[model samples]
Target: MQFRLVKIAETSKKKQTFIFLAAILLALFTTGLFIMFLGHDPVKVYLSLVNGAFGSRYRIEQTLIKAIPLIITSLGIAIAFRMKFWNIGAEGQITMGAFCASYLALNYSYLPRPVLLSLMLLGGFIGGSIWGIIPAFFKAKWGTNETIVTLMMNYVALKWIIYLQYGPWKDPAALGFPKIPNFAENAILPKFLGLHIGWVIALFLVISVHIFMNYSKKGFEIAVIGESVNTARYAGIEIFKTIVLAMFLSGGICGLVGMIQASGVNLTLSKDITGGVGYTAIITAWLGALKPHWIVLVSILFAALVQGSSYIQTAFGISAASAQLLEAIILFFVLGSDFFAKYRLVIDWKGLSRKKENKL
Candidate 1:
């Protein structure tokens, strides 16, 4: 017998949900075994994870803080993915955004707080937009592979930030250490109810994106292009314009994450300002099915997982590598389920018989 994979043209919502639920249960059970092997009670370790993520107001706040950048970045990714644009340069876009915003913050420290902060946001959007446009322009004009170009741009952006931190932008006050100067108080984001206003911005973008993707004319054009470039052209959609515009919006939103992280979380520009959120957001965007509201839920869950795993390292004496391994196992199982939801494995007896006949 031979095995073949068959795509499911349509799966009921109920079936899809069941597959994902089963995947989660299986992931938990598998992780439980891992925990048991490590000499810890699985149930207790699981409880600790929940407690660490949301047992108290402080813990919940920490999870939300982690989710803020994730939510925004995933939203940006979703926009590009919706247009079937593989924008892998969120890292570069984010870094460039922070770098641009930092330039204004460091130079215009004398400006009023409101004005400087607003300009920083605009600068960040512009910086990221430009980075995103580079790949989109090439793809539209010369049929370049966006995936490779975007991936390469990430390193370019990283090198630029490293140069700034160690070279011209280095703070002389650091006493020979390579560090960028901290943003002035005027450049920093204000907090409301113990959380920086980034959470509010995240929520706003989620709603705005939902509307734009589902209701706007430009969004329809992007969707058409994603479905088929030929169809888009036949439908009179401006393929080049739409591609560039969609990417501009995608990269601009990602840029906002950089500004929020630099101004609200890190309080300064650094080589590590992104913390790999740009890459992580891709998983969230896909898992969320490129939906804005779903992205919020996925980002929060991912944030909880990270926060809980970190907590377990300290609370249960679990090593960092083990905690990360647990996260990887869960993600593996969950992502695998998506494959099964869309396709099924079948025994290809006819093909096996045909092969035997040929041999005979």
Candidate 2:
């Protein structure tokens, strides 16, 4: 018998929810087997993961800090994805944003705190927007493959940061070490409660994106373009303008993550400022189905997974590679479920019979 795949035109919300939950359960079960293979009790390890992520106020705060960058970067990615534009340059955009913000912070240390911080934010946004626009312009003007261009730009941005860190921007205070100077007090973000104000910014962006994507005119144009460029043009939507604007917004939001990380978490610009959040955000954006509200939930869950994985390394003596493997397995199953939700496998009896007849 031959096997074939058929797309499901539609699935009920309840069924989709059931499939999602089942996927998670299956993932957990499968991961448990792996844990057992490693001679650890699965149930205890699971509990430890939960505790590591949210057992106490401090743990929860740390999870939130991890989620902040994920949430912001995912939102940016979702915007571009909504228009079917593959923006893989978030890492570069983020680096450029931090570099731009640091320029102002390092040079204008004499400015008042609020003013310098605001200028830094603007600079970060502009930097990312400019990076995003480069790919958009090429795609709009010459039909360039955006995915390749954006991916290549990421390395360019990384090298730029590395050059600055080791060359001109190197802090002379460090004795023969490559490091950028830390941001002045005026450049750092203030904390609200125990966490930096980034959490508040994340929440604000979540609400704003939901509104923009669902209620705004430009949002409608983006959706239409994603569906069909021809349809969008027939509907009088400006394809070039929409693509560029959407990407501008996407990259700028991602840039904010850089600014927040540099100013709040690292307190200085570095080659590792992104911590691979740009790439991770793509997973969150897709898993969240490109929805702003859903992105928040997905980002938080992902953050918890990362935080818990780190904790298990110390708490249960689980090696880092094993913990990472556990995460990969879970993500694989969960992503597979999304595919199954939209399609089904079937035995092609007719095709098999025809093949047998031909052989006979």
Candidate 3:
């Protein structure tokens, strides 16, 4: 007998939805089994997760706060991936954005609040755009491997922030402690109902991106280029320009997340400002199918996981790693199920026999 995997001509949206939901339910079931082995009730653990993420008004707000950065970063990643650009340097871009924005916050203490905030945002945008465009430029000009370049840039940006925290940018008034000084009030983002304005901005960008991608000529060009460079060239789509532009937007949005973190949440630039959101955004983007609206939903769910998992550790005595393990298991099932959605295995005993007969 022989088995062959054949691609499906077209998967219905309803089937795709069913498959993904099944993956999620299966992951939860698997995690429940593990919890049973650990002597804890799975239902209780799940309730704890829900309570941790949204039981209280305060918890809901906190979850939304975490979701803000994830939403922004994931949207940025979605933009790049739509163009088939693997921009792995979002972490670096975030770090650099925070680092650059911090310079204005730390140095220009005399500027008006509005101007300082604007300048800091611009700095963050410029910093992230530069980092993003570098790899794009090289890829466009020489066909350099963008993945490697972007990934390496992340370490470079990371080390730069670490150096700032411990070296020249270190706070002098901290009594010999190694840390960057916090931003001035003028540099900080304003809050609304316990959440920063970054959330508002993130939502605005989300809608804007959705409209831009779904209803613009430029978006069509990007889609064409992503599908095939040769086809894009045949259509006169300025391939190099589109690649660079897509990357710039991608990196710039990630940088905006960094600025928001520094100015709104952390109130300073630090090595930990990103909090792994850059990497998480990649997953969110993929899980969301690179759609802005879908990305928001995925980011919120992930944010809940992060917020709730910490509660699971404290409330249920589960290890912190368990949450991460849960995430991995869910991702595994979802990714694996995508294969079955796209293809089906067919067994062909007659074909196997014919092959064997010919060989004999």
Candidate 2: global Cα-lDDT?
A: 0.91
| TM-score list, all predictions | 0.91, 0.93, 0.94
Model 1 residue 312 lDDT? Answer: 89
Query: Residue-wise lDDT of candidate 2 within 196-233, one digit each (tens)?
Result: 99999999999999999999999989999999999999
Residue-level lDDT of model 3, residues 109-220, one tens digit each, is 6899989999999998888888899999999999999999999999999998888889998899998898898888899999876789999989999998898788998887
Candidate that beats the other on TM-score, 1 or 2, i.e. the better one: 2
Q: What is the C-alpha lDDT of each candidate?
A: 0.91, 0.91, 0.90
The full ranking of all candidates by TM-score, starting with the best, is 3, 2, 1
Candidate 2 TM-score, C-alpha based: 0.93
Question: Clash number for every model?
Answer: 0, 0, 0
State candidate 1's TM-score.
0.91
Judge candidate 2 at residue 94 and give its lDDT.
Answer: 94
Show model 2 residue runs off by greater than 4 Å: 1-6, 321-327, 344-360
